[model samples]
Target: MSATLYYFDGRGKAEIVRLAMAAAKVPFTQVDIKEKQQFETLRAEGKLIFGQLPMVEYEGNHLVQSCSIARYFASKGNFLGSNEQERLKVDILFEGTRDFNTAFMPYGFLGFKEVLDNAKNTAMPRYLPIYNFILSRNGSNGHLVGSKLSLADLGLLEVILTIEELLGEDELKPYPEVQNFLKVMKSNEGLASYLRSDLRRRKNDERYVAEVKGVLY
Candidate 1:
């Protein structure tokens, strides 16, 4: 299938799908609608969406919503789960990540100081313990649910990285398992390469080393 990821030129919600595509070794086109003029054209044509971004145009079908697109590409790459139970586990992780993302939203898009203060005071303290509990229930420190990698792990990594970015690398210091999990995932070759790739740098501008790397594992 010819897969095209359509989004703003920069990395936004659609970033996970891009990382997933690269990690899966699935060749796809990156459609960057950077210019406002082009954005207006797409928006007027009902192509660019209000509630979604980084949407995927797959063989004439436009897939809206970031998580849905992630799952679509993940399924294509066999990254969702190997079974039903695992799939549910993946759902939990994704939702948890979404929750974490939601918690962080109050602080995001604002200046770094406002974002950091909110995160440190409200977001981090609230979410971190819940995440720690999830890890405790799973089996060990690193794995969130199954003995192996799941989409949830990727989601967790994504949130954790966000925390790290906001609060600095030691943001995850309180959760050793999460830190260890991130470390291991980053070592995965496919994921590692994607994080280090020019595309990621171009999109994020800042160096991103956590969740994108975890997805490939």
Candidate 2:
């Protein structure tokens, strides 16, 4: 089946979806809307669901929401889980990453030193410990669900890398399991290649950072 992902030019919410597809060796077209005018035009045309991005057109069907789209691709690639319980474990960690992103994105967009400090001091302490615990429970094998790779792993990897970029390399040092998990995920051939490819944007690209800051401030 043919698939095309629609999102902003930068990584943002769509990176997990792209990572999943790439890891699974699934071929699909990526449509990056680089201009606000293009995004507005698509929204005005009523083509985007929920008036937002990270939508996927798969086999003529439109799927919305970043997590849902990523899950769909994971299912298609057989990276979800082998059974019901495993799927639940995967979902829990996947949703946890989403919650972490929800808490982190606002501070990122605020683009102020105080906001960053608050996140570093308060929010990270609250959330990272829980994520670190989850990783420890799973043996910190770089896979968040079962003993194999899942969408949860990809999701957590994105969040971890984003946090590392915003904070620093040593930000996850307090969570050794999480740090090990990051190393394992980055060692995957497909993910490693994608990270080095032109398709992947630097986490702190000024253009995307400025765009987010402008929208918030």
Taking all chains together, the TM-score of candidate 2 against the true structure is 0.86
Model 2 regions lying over 4 Å from their true place: 204-206, 209-217
Question: For candidate 2, which ten residues in a row score worst on lDDT?
Answer: 103-112
The per-residue C-alpha lDDT of model 2 at residue 37 equals 75
Best by TM-score, which number? 2
Cα RMSD to native, each candidate?
6.5, 2.7
| Clash pairs for candidate 1 | none
Task: Record all residue pairs in model 2 with backbone atoms less than 3 Å apart, i.e. clashing.
Answer: none
Model 1: per-residue Cα lDDT over 66-155, one tens digit each:
887777777776777778988887887778787777655433245446656766887678878887777777766476767766567666
Clashes of each: 0, 0
Give the distance in Å from residue 189's predicted Cα in candidate 2 to where it truly belongs.
2.0
* Candidate 1: Cα lDDT at 171: 74
Candidate 1: deviation at residue 44, Å?
A: 4.6
lDDT of each: 0.67, 0.77
